[model samples]
Target: MELPVGGHPADKYQNPKTMKTRVIILLAIFLSAFALLPDRVIKGTVTDGSHTPIAGVNVSIQGGGSGTVTDRAGRFAIRVPNLARALVFKKTGYKSLTMPVTSDSVLNVALTQATLKTEELADQILDHSKQPGQAEKSLAFNRVAAAPATFSGAVMQMQVPTESYKPINENGFLSVGQQPVTTFSVDVDRAAYSNVRRFLNSGQMPPEDAVRIEEMINYFDYNYPQPAGEHPLAITTETTDSPWNPGLKLVHIGLQAKTVSTENLPASNLVFLIDVSGSMSDPNKLPLLKQAFKLLVDQLRAEDKISLVAYAGSAGLVLPPTAGSEKKVIKDALDKLEAGGSTAGGEGIELAYGLAKKHFLPKGNNRVILATDGDFNVGISNESELQKLIEEKRKAGIFLSVMGFGMGNYKDSHVETLADKGNGNYAYIDNIQEARKEFVQEFGGTLFTIAKDVKIQIEFNPAHVQAYRLIGYENRALRNDEFNDDQKDAGDMGSGHTVTAIYEIVPKGVQTSYIGTTEALKYQQNHVRATGDSDEMMTVKVRYKKPDSEKSILFDLPVKAATLAFEKCSENLRFASAVAEFGLLLRGSEYKGKATYADVIQRARAAFGKDEEGYRSEFVQLVKTAQSLDGSQETARK
Candidate 1:
């Protein structure tokens, strides 16, 4: 037979150099055939902060819309039009990179690893491990990380990569990769692990249920105080016996943050502090944020004035204080913003607050809306400095509202603190819909402050109730002393925003006990006490200061009999409880007992009252994704 036109399979396989040369020749010939045609080849390598190669990275040309993944050697190549301007590189667990495609085809990119706290790792381990007990152990280790250190004061840093790593023992040591092995350790007393195990076995997780209570109360759509006059703030409390732990009763408290509308509302002087940093170049960041603000701009009246300040490596006032009626001017200023340069967030806040004070509208809704990824690279990099700065600004009568955007390098803790100190609200905008929920749909409630330093304190009648736990306010809980302190600011409630809180209670004479009793009160008198016989269980107390007031007004609502039917309560309570349980699981709270995604979904589905916004349905999807992640983690753990 005649020799093959090209070459034998063995020849092509064995003589790889010759085969490569032949392929190159063919490609060159093909390009030469179309001499005038414009073509380009963009190639780059992706590496970690340490300059170590990271394989399987994704590289894409922005406008060209073509993409490829890097090989084992971290090299990626993509063919594009010669006029192709730039390319973007992205990978999980690392900051994305983007660069212009200049004459040099070879480009090297370094991606910074995202920071993860031990608590976050615990969440990941619980959600991603494949084994049954592994998640529980990882959760225990995380708790140990948070325990008070009995040894030296050195901070123990822990890193759990998105990719799975080997299991860590009680001593807190794990290895990953062959070349650069990573290790972690936490300060644990001799009996710490055993103590934690005992606590778990005793079913005594932290009083996390109390924490959730505050968040649930805060998350409701409460009616706010109108600018008209002082009115009686109303909150309704409904309770029922718990199904899981019959000894504990479930109480739902709903607060309506309402304000009577006055003929003349206070004039609002608002400053829009926007981040134009390079990291915010993503469509979801600056573009979506701009769109979200436009909705708010449309809701503004003639009494309102808005100023714009933008920062990226430098801070500048893009627009002078202008009347809300001048929509064109504001829109043009917003449209001119372009993302580039490093983030100078601290400077941006300073400039924005300065502008707000310059045009301060006393007795009005004076506020600075800070929208960013919470990434401050320039001066005042520490959270304390930023917090102090915000505190000082708040003294000038301008409140702060923090809107967090994007994903990588998101500083949730920092944003939350800033909002807390500035006497404002904090919200994360994950999509345009949430933006509408924050800005357009809830414009007045979002921008106007009805009540400030609002705190809830409920004293249960020990005779009627045995024990109680609040749900979902782990970070927001105020110390008992901080409750009455006027200077100690808490959360703000907006007009029309509802706040709901749940407390699980146990009735006296019940056979079960959720919490162990401290040796019965010593030396108490044995005087015969009359039993009221009323079904009343507890009295709820709420204290709040007017937006401009220093002292707080207290309100009380008494909850009497319990209801067993879940059908009587609004869907909001049931749906909120599901989310609360999900958060508890993510934190691996000691309180979680036999709670699963399945339970959450079932509860949510049953209580999913007219979900016109579809938030409840979306919650189901999130639960599913979390469940899948949990399954994967279990597998890995095994």
Candidate 2:
């Protein structure tokens, strides 16, 4: 019963025009104030009480719907209403934090570790165990739930770990007199490094099978020459003394693809195949997935196109092929996604591939990026069918890029197999920073393929090198005959990608006990040694096909013997040596001669040359952590 603004109580009762005018004036004032309350992007870093960055922390605007999670680097960027009062930062086993909203663009937060309750541990632990023929991977959800892990100031969880990793037997020495050729398919995937890091960070030693040394070595960028002529890749070689053993030589082979600037990169027609199953209900899986993809959406150009296909109990196209310029629309769809129901990943793949083909761009990037925890229950039955499907689709010129998320029930074998057969690469996104690295920082290298079916064959001169063993890549080994078969499938390299391989070699004159004498056959005399190529240690031959071509081109380089001391080797060799040595210790390889955590720490510190992203620095920290844990009495080495 109050009088209208600017009108007496009696006049308000007598004049309807005055009341209407007042109502319009008041509405204009309210709208003006509301329009002035624009959204602002807030950037920040979250850390624990120790000041170490904490990944996977949920950051949300209080009383607002917008939210995001911290990346591996503990950094996050979120858009919030200007009038928001506070932000809530939360992570399991950490005390929840709420800080008043401020005008500052950067907000740094630190949360203290909390004593975890049984329910908390039950909800937080990420474990997925698999046994052969048991279908543990596909049947993970149906089994009874496991117990919670013991907590100790959040240092390490005491629980039965269930992550799946295929058994990897370290390669041993091969006498050049018997086998003179070393061949392997090139592998550009780096998922192993991040996955292994996750294990260490969780205070557990990574299962030996999870350590793919070639993938680890290739994760970091090394300075190498670019392709000069018709080839899309350039080669570099280095040799030095092996750090683990005396008198043994180590050879480094590096391939660097030509760098194509963003402006010159081809238009992209992309399909985002996502998993929204009940297993992905974990915050790190589906929720983090949505945020991770938003980073890619932000990088899209007007010419690029994006489509989204989500699968759970079934598969459906959430967003049709739309221009990348419609970023808001794409991101809105991403934001609306929720996790529930069983996974029908196989059907999702078919739909995604079909869409990619339908919108396929000739002479451009046509790809399907699958985001999932690798739990495909309803759709794909076994890998044989999955591989056959992906392989067929890839032949249609639509490549796959797998972005693995979540932990429990993760089917790494399936992820790796899909990437391998589909002529693509795989990466595990443990946090938001890693997503940015994939979708923003290494945008070109993650999507655009420059070469396919890339393979390497090295002919060792027995006269100079007596024995050699490839440091890693047990799974990528190819039959010598397969190298020459153009129809054989191999790893594909992306633009600006680098692949490195190392070999531990024993010289002809070096009397190494590891290469025990092989008795000559009584019926067949040992083949005579060929010394014609004694001038060179090995001839490194490479074969690769263009993105659109079926025929592969051949190239070769004769590498002379290296005489540099281990300490005097190039930074590339030294760093690679450091990483390889670390892998050796992690895998507990029989060949980890004289390798110690101290040596790895020192060597990595010296080679932390151009770590612009702090990855090398993080490696050093992980090594130190492993050194600490492995030294604990409970984990004493034999």
Best lDDT among the predictions, by candidate number? 2
Which residue runs does candidate 2 get wrong by more than 4 Å? Answer: 1-162, 520-529, 633-638
In model 1, state the lDDT of residue 479.
61
Error of 1 at 183 (Å): 41
The runs of at least 3 residues in candidate 1 whose Cα sits more than 4 Å from the true structure, single-residue gaps closed, are: 1-232, 259-265, 511-514, 523-534
| Total residue pair clashes for candidate 1 | 43
Best candidate (score: TM-score): 2
lDDT of 1 by residue, 1-638 (tens): 34465755546345878888999999989867766576778777887776756554667888757666664356778886765678887754355677888888788888775443445434544553433212222322221222111112232333221211112111111111111111111000011111111222111222222122243224434323322335434676667655444445678776676643533457789999999987677655787688778877887777799999999999998999989899888988899999988889888898998888888877788999999877777867787888888988886778999887754345555666688788787776654556777787667667777777777776555456555566544455566667667777677776666666666555666544345644444332131123246566666777788787889887666777667566566665666667666655644555555678798889878876666665455456445545644443444345
- TM-score of candidate 1 against the unseen true structure: 0.65
Query: TM-scores for all candidates?
Result: 0.65, 0.83
Compose the digit string of candidate 2's lDDT tens values, residues 1-638. 77777755766367888788999999999978986987999998998767888766789989868688776578899998866889999765467899998989899999886655446544554332222211333322211121112233323334223456677878999988778898999998999998877666654566678889988898888888899988898889988888889889899999988888988989999999999988787766887799889999998999999999999999999999989899999999998898888889999999999999999999899999999878788978587999999988888899999999877567787788889898999999887777888889999899989899999999988768889999999999999999999999999998899999999999888987778887643432333334654678899999999999999999999999757877777778888889999999988898888999899989888888878898887787778667755664133222
Report the error of model 2 at residue 555, Å.
Answer: 0.7
Each candidate's number of clashing pairs is: 43, 5
Candidate RMSDs in order? 15.8, 6.2
TM-score, model 2 to reference:
0.83
